[model samples]
Target: MTTAVITFSPQGLKVMQRIASHMAVDQYLHQAIAAPPGVTPFERVVALTGEIFSRYEGLVYVAPCGVVVRAIAPLVDSKLRDPAVVCLDVGARHAMSVLSGHEGGANDLAIAVANITGAEPVISTTTEAVKDLIVGIGCRKGKSAADIVTAVTTALAGLELPLERVRLLATADVKAQEAGLLEAAAQLNIPLRVIDSDLIRHSTRPFGHSEFVASHVQLPAVSEPAALLAGRRTSLLLQKTAFNGITVAIARENCPSLA
Candidate 1:
């Protein structure tokens, strides 16, 4: 599905560009706001939204939730037919599924944006919110996508978990640009969260330390820390496991009731 990111303010435009830089998405900026090349500028949000409401499969608004709600209020229809709408703060702090959370693929889009921007995905769907599996991966440079997939699938299979249960695949931002990692995520149809190195370094949660990782990536550990930090109320369901040049860890996010 085609996606577009739109914003009104300069700060929001920066966030929009950050997302668009990683994902294959179009950009729409308010006419009054200045932007770099490749971003289409529009006169009014309401008019622009109407024009592209049906044109794109996904719409990410890098503005306040109220602004997005107001712009798309009139265009909302059935979830089956409407495009997925995600609301993101201008700071790129949270990606919320504002419309058609489940049926329209907004939930997935929210997670994808969050994964790319190191933002939190605000998914309110009961089933999704309660979801437990997070797979964190760390691989040597230039590993094949097939190798990464095989290692992840093997790790999940050891615990008899299905692929659908794996909501997020997280890795340090240092590995975020790896083509193999990105392709594995695309092949699995899951979001690959790129956690900042500083966040991992400063995380309160305890994880195993790897001297090699500390030397190269400047982090204590990659897979374990990434798994534990990706979601809310998380705990390590499975510790880091190695296969060939890849290391994988699994973390489970507890539901509110469970917590």
Candidate 2:
């Protein structure tokens, strides 16, 4: 998704710079800019916001909530069509999802911004408040889509979690182009996230490993690391399980309850 970060003061600009770097490291597409000198930044943000509302999926404004709300007022439409708008204090102490909290991803953006800037994210979305499950999978070179689906479903069933409880499916970067994996993700209606092999190895010690897989892929394991990386947690709810040439793992992260 495309994102834009606009700031008013120098402090906000500094925070925006940090946010940009963080987003880039996480492979997020983003644009960052400060308002021009001598002109009112709020006015510039307002003008640019009108265009960004349609052009970008997310908007980050580092200024007061009032300024952001007023600036985007004219372009405000239904939440379904509006871009996710996140407002941060000038000091970068708080990141607030002011509009389009769920469907537009403002709440998730807030949490990511908070992780980068060490600020508290103020997200009020109800669904976002619930913890999401991440499912990680590894399959044979030419596994069938049906086999992949069966492996994932069996893993979730072991944990007594329904398929709808899963929010994301992750696998090693090598599997990013796997037709079976992609097809299974499409059938399940969840995002298929690909993680770099090195990042996966460094994420956490694999719950299970195979010397054969290590020789071929140069990674200790695939499913366990993919789950930990996507869930941002160290432990797994279910360790690697192999069935019919498909391996699956499950992990959960505790999301902060809405206050």
Candidate 3:
């Protein structure tokens, strides 16, 4: 989905530019969407917003809510088909998902934007409050996507959790190149978040470790700390389970504060 980040002022444009820089580097971590125009091409807010509503899948409006709402009022349509819209204050203090919070991907976009701008994300989606489950996975270098799906789905079933409850799939940064893991997440329609291995190894809570894993990844474990780090939880819903060549761990939390 293409993201159109529209700024109303020079300061807002500057902040959006900074966000664009991070987006470039993190493209692989998250699906890369088209970069927003460097500068706001249209001088008029209403015209720009109408054009965005017509053209983009996502909209990042770096301006006051009132301004954004007024500009896009005429374009408002059914939530089922409307584009996801996020509003960030010109000061970059808060990122709020203004429309299509879940199905349209606005909530995740708000969090992503907040991650870049150090802004507090105001996520009000009901599912976000209730469905905060993170699945952590680790596997051999050449595991198949089907193997990953089987391992993860079996774990979730044992825990009595539905797939829709999953908010993200996490793994160590070193495994960012792991094709099986990426394909599994893509198949399941879950966002894959890669956490730095240092942070995982230095986690406050002890994780299940192994000498073999240490020899390979320099860390005793991957899924546990990766899940804890991504979920911001102190405990796991399901301990590490290994089958064939894949390992899966489950973590649960209720919309923990973003890092």
- How many clashing pairs in candidate 1? 0
Candidate 1, residue 221: Cα displacement in angstroms equals 1.1
For all candidates in order, the CA lDDT equals 0.90, 0.75, 0.77
**Residue pairs in candidate 2 whose N, alpha carbon or C atoms collide under 3 angstroms:** none
CA RMSD per model (angstroms): 2.4, 6.8, 6.4
- Of models 2 and 3, which has the larger TM-score? 3
Candidate 3: regions farther than 4 A off? 7-47, 62-74, 87-96, 107-123, 196-198, 210-220, 232-234, 254-259
Worst 10 residues of 1 by lDDT: 123-132
lDDT of 1: 0.90
Best by TM-score: 1
Candidate 3 residues 1-259, lDDT tens each?
6787776566776677877776642111101223343343565778767755867778888878998899889998978888988999979878899998888888878867775675656777876656678888989999988899999999999988999988878888778779888889889877676676767677777778878789998987988887877754436888889978888888887445532
Question: What does candidate 1's lDDT look like per residue over 23-78, in tens digits?
Answer: 89999998888768999999999999999999999999999899899999999989
Estimate candidate 3's alpha-carbon lDDT, on a 0 to 1 scale: 0.77
Clashes of each: 0, 0, 0
Q: Highest lDDT: which candidate?
A: 1
Winner by lDDT between candidate 2 and candidate 1: 1
Ranking by TM-score: 1, 3, 2
- Between 2 and 3, whose lDDT is larger? 3
Which whole-number lDDT from 0 to 100 does residue 136 have in model 2?
87
